[model samples]
Target: MSTSRGAPGSVLAVDAGNSKTDVAVIGADGRVLGTGRGGGFQPPLVGVQVAVDTLADAVTTALEQAGADCVDHVSACLANADLPVEEEELAQAVQARGWGRSTEVRNDTFAILRAGVDEPRGVAVVCGAGINCVGMLPDGRTARFPAIGKISGDWGGGSGLAEEALWFAARAEDGRGAPTQLARTLPAHFGLASMYALIEALHLGRIPAVRQHEVAPLVFTVSAAGDPVARSLVHRLADEVVAMASVALGRLGLLTEEAPVLLGGGVLAARHPELDDRIAVLLAQRAPKAVVRVVAAPPVLGAALLGLDHVAAPAQAHRTLRAHYA
Candidate 1:
C-alpha cells in the first residue's frame, strides 16, 4: 500500500522563530486555506528532532484544516539558520517528513525582506531578539550576515541595546559615567531602589534574564528625553543598520541604483521617530540611492509568497496572496 499523506498542488509555508512558529497552507488559486501557530523552532534549545516535530505539528494541523494531504512546495524561513550549512540541514530535515515534494529553507530575515518588497531584489535588516540582514539582486546576487552575536561581530539588537542600557545605568550610579535619567529610571523600571538592587535581582534570578529585552524601549525613552549616553546608543544602532545595508548594496552593485531597503523585526517596526530619522539620514549620506521602507507585513506572508514563487504561481496569484495576507 502506498502511504504518502498529502496532495500535490498546495504550498506549505512556515516561518519559524526563536519564540514561536507560524504556518500556513495556500492553494494554487492563492487562497489561504489554513493557518496554525506552534512553539519555537530553535534547534539550539530544543534538538533538531523536537524542533522539526514542533514544525510537523503545526504543518499537520494546517494541512488537516485545509483538507489537503500534501503540498507541492515547502517554503520555510527559520530563525537561527545563521549558516548555509544550517539552512541545508533544516531543508533536508523538512523534506524528510514528506509534507511536500520539494522544500526551500532560508534565514528568517529573508521572509521579512520578501514580504515588504514587490520584487525579490533589495536588502532587509531584522532587529528583533537579535539582528540579521540579507540582500538579493535581480541577477541573483546576494549578501547576508552570520548573525551569531558577538562571535560573528554583530551588534544592535534588543538584547544588545538592553545590555548597553544597563551598562550606562550602572556606570552613572557609580559616578563612572555622566549622570543621566537612566540612573533613576532603569532601577525604577523593576521597582528597585538602585542599580545595585536591580543587578542583584537579575543575578539571583529574582528578575528573569529574558526580561532584559524590556529595557530597550526605556533606552529609547531616555534618549528621547535628551540623555547623551542614551542618544549615542540609539545613533550607534542606526549606524550599525546603515552599515549592513550599505555593504549589501555594494555587494550587489546597487549603490547607485534606487533599491528598496526593508526594515523589519520588533526594533525597526516600532518606528521610533528618532531612530528612524537617524537611520534615514545616515543612509542618505552613505548609500544615496537606497530607498528605505519599514515592513509591516507579518513574516509568514513572506514565507507564503516564497512558496508561491516556488510553484511558479502567476503574478496575479502573488497579488491575490499579498492582498489576502494584507
Candidate 2:
C-alpha cells in the first residue's frame, strides 16, 4: 500500500477515454520519456480496427518522442473496455506492437484507482465525460459499471449532464417540463436564440455528440446562477454519482464508517467542489467512519501508476514516470 518505485525497464502506459486517448513512456529512473495524445478510440463508435490503428499510432508516436525504439512492457487502461472480448482485442493489439515484449489491459477505472489511492484495497468512482466506477477488495472481488453506452442507466457522468440539459430544453419548449432558464441559457451558450434553433443545428449534422458535452459546463453556469431547475438537476447528478460509489462500497462491506472512498473524473473534478464536499458529508452521514477524498491526479497518471505498480518498478522508474507524466 505504498507509493514506492518499481523495477528497471521502460513502461508504456495508455489511457483511452471517451474524449481523448493518451500515451506515456517512462524510463527505469521514473522519468517520463515521451507522451502523446489523440481522439477517443472506442470500438463502439469507431471500428475496432480503426481503434487499434489509432492506438498504435499514438503509442509509436510516444516512443519516438521518448527516443526509444521499443518498450519492455505495456499497460493499457481503456474506457469502454468492460467486456472480456473487448479487453482481449485491445490486449492483442497492444502486444502486437512489441511494447516491452509483454502487455496487460484493463478498464480505465482500475487505472484511476491505481493513480489515486496507494492501497490495493478501496473503491473509485469516475464521473468524467462518462460515469463509471471500478473497485478491488483485499478479498479479490472486483466490480465495474456495465457501461451499456448511453442506452443503459449511465447517468452520473458528463453525457448525463448533456442529456439532462437537452431533455429540459425539449420539455420547456413543449410545456411538458418546467419553465427553466435552461431554455435561454443553452441557446446563449451555443450562440442560438431558441431551443428550436439548437435542434435545427443538431439535425443538420452541424453538431456532433462531442459538442453535446459542452452542455455540461452550461449546467454548472445555470446552477451557479441559482436557477431552481438547474439546481435540482445538479443535485440529481450528485446523488446519482454518490449512489454509484455507494454500490461499490456496499458490496465490499466498506459502507461502514471507516472505509476509504475516492471520487474522480472531469465532471466531478471541475464545477463540483461543493458536490465533493457534499459527497464527503453524505458519506459521513451514511457511515460516520468512512474516509472520502477527491482524487487530484488525472486518470492517465493513474494508468501510468498501474504500469509501475504491476512491474514492481524501481524507485528510479517511478521517479522517471512521475516526472515524465508530470
Candidate 3:
C-alpha cells in the first residue's frame, strides 16, 4: 500500500497579497488551465469573510476560464495570513468551496519563495507594496521578518518610501531638518506649489493614508532626476533590503558565493535597470555568490506547482511542471 496521500485530480492555487489576489487552475499535468484576479484581500482591511469571498470569486473565475469541472486540491498563499485564527478561518471557508479534496494555507511570502526557485531551500526577498524576507535552510531552519506595515516602523517599501518623503518634506518645510528638494517636489505631486498650503489641505482631511502610497512614484522619478534626497532614500532602502537578506543568509549559512539569492517582488519587478544595478552592486559587496533573479509570474503559480509536486511523480515531475508553466 502507498504510504503517501495524493490528490485525485487537478488543483487550484491562489496568491493573495496586499495589493491584489490571483488564482490559477492547474491540471494534473501541471498546465495552467486558467487564471483570474480579484481585489486586495488583506484581512485587516476587508475582514476574513471579505477576503474569503474575494478569493472564492477569483478561484471560481479561474475555474470558469479553464472550463474545468472539478479540482482535487487547493493551495492558498495569502499575505497577513499569519495568525492561527486567520488561517483557520480561511481554511474553513475554502473547504466549503470544495475546489479539491485538500486545502493548505500559507503566507504569501512562502509562495514568493516557491515561485522563484524549484525547491526553495534558499532565501527570497520580497519588496512589493511592502518589504519582507523569508529564508529556509536545508535543515528546515526558517527565518522571516515581522513584515507589519503600519504601526511598525518597517521601512523600505513603496508605501514606506512615500511616507519617508512626506516626513522629509514636512521637516524641511518646518526648518526642523535638513533642507530637501522633497519639500518642493511634494507640492508638485499634489498639484500645489507651496508646502504650507499642502499642510493646510492635509490637516483639513484632504489627503488620506491610502493616497500616501501614490507618492512613491514621485520619489522614484525625482530620484532618477538627480534629486539628492530622493536618491538617498532609494539607496537607503536598497541597503536595508540587502541587510535583511544578509541576516537571513547568515541564519542559513548561505552567506558565501555558493548559495543563490532569489529576488521576488513588485518593486524588483518594476525592471528599473538602475535599481537592478544598485541591488547587484550591494549583493556583490555583501553576499557575492547570491544569485538574483526576478520572478516574472505570480507567486501563486509557484504554490500551485507545489501542490502538483505533492501528487505527481518525483524524478521528472519538476521538469514537467516547469514545461507546463513555460
Alpha-carbon TM-score of each model against the true structure: 0.96, 0.87, 0.86
Q: lDDT by residue for model 2 over 1-326, one digit each (tens)?
A: 11112224567889988678999886655667778887887787777777777777788788887877677668889887887688898898778767666788888888778776655577788887777887777455776678666576777577778888888987998799999889988877888888988888887877765688889888878888888788777887777767777878777777764666777788866746656666766666665666777777767777777777766777566565555545
TM-score of 2: 0.87
Considering only N, C-alpha and C atoms within 3 Å, which residue pairs clash in candidate 3? 72-100, 72-101, 73-100, 257-289, 261-291
Model 2 scores a C-alpha lDDT of 0.75
Order by TM-score, highest first = 1, 2, 3
Q: Give per-residue CA lDDT, model 1, range 16-71, as digits (tens).
A: 99989999988886778888899888898877777899887888888887877778
lDDT of 3: 0.75
In terms of TM-score, the best-performing candidate is 1
Residue-by-residue lDDT tens digits, candidate 3, 70-95 = 47788888888754466677877777
Write down the lDDT of every candidate, Cα atoms only. Answer: 0.89, 0.75, 0.75
Kindly provide the TM-score of model 1 when superposed on the true structure, using C-alpha atoms. 0.96
User: Model 2 off-target regions past 4 Å?
Assistant: 1-9, 65-67, 138-140, 314-320, 323-326
Worst 10 residues of 2 by lDDT: 1-10
